[model samples]
Target: MPPITPRKPQRRALLIGICYKHTHQDDWPELLLTHRDVDRFRALLRSRYDYADDEITVMKDDEAVPSRLWPTAQNIRRELDRLVRGTAAGDQLVLLFCGHSDQLDTEETKDKTEEDGQDEVIIACDAKRIVDNELKYRLVTSLHAGVNLTVRVLSLS
Candidate 1:
């Protein structure tokens, strides 16, 4: 009898990490926690998937990334969509963000209600704050991505 051939599986990985400080501004904070997240996330992917170190992409909220590729909430959403749609089926995508997860009141607004027409939104690392509309945009983009999605948000716990 002829030998049966096996079909190999394909996998994909994506990364998002926040190396910035929310309480105070600095180029980037120097903390072991940040390093821990970097190591832990890499190890998690390495142990589970057969991805080479280079195959995985690391993104930060700091200057390490080009101003264009910074891991802003919107950019992260877009990259996730790309990773999910770009990879073949059976592949996986992982996203991690570590920093301040907060809400702020800014000068942006829309009619929330007849009484409370003005509203504010939460921003991540950007100097600007985001609003409900932006959040919705990001979410919709992610839903349309059509790939296995795994997201992790790390805060001071």
Candidate 2:
């Protein structure tokens, strides 16, 4: 008789990317890579699936109006928790992050290292680099500590 192995459950996907522009000439390598990677991933998930505009949240870097803390990483984590704690079982939940992935371990800023930090930090219209760590993953321990929902990350730049 063949032994049976348990299969991991799957959830819905939430995709986020920050491309276009980031740094200057000296930082071209990282910047260029980030853009290409983000573009590739965005095109992947957004193809063939007809999802409502709200279902798919997009945060892009614009010279005019970029995303701040509220609508950036905070929004992403909030949405993830809402789904995990809500009665949406059997329903898929996916979280996709695209950009430059870095390790933020400095005590001063280590606590808050989401996609918005170091990765998608852009010169917003208000001139602020969004911090990702502010999101309350502590209240909902099931997230960054490898909790509920499916997380997919792709880096082009």
Q: How many residue pairs clash in each candidate?
A: 1, 13
Task: Write down the TM-score for model 1.
Answer: 0.57
What TM-score fits each model? Answer: 0.57, 0.46
Kindly list the per-residue Cα lDDT of model 2 for residues 1-157, writing each as its tens digit: 9998645543344455554354333332333343355445556656755444455544444444344422244554554555565333244555565554433334546645344344333222122334344333422344433444555656432
Against the true structure, what is every candidate's RMSD?
A: 6.5, 9.2
Q: What is the lDDT of residue 79 in candidate 2?
A: 48
Clashing pairs in 1: 16-96
Q: Top TM-score: which candidate number?
A: 1
User: On residues 1-157, what C-alpha lDDT tens digit does candidate 1 reach at each position?
Assistant: 9997644544555665665554255533433465468667888788876678765767665655676556676766566556555454444566665654543333335445424554434334553444545544554454433445576666542
Q: After superposition, how far is residue 90 of candidate 2 from its true place, in Å?
A: 1.5
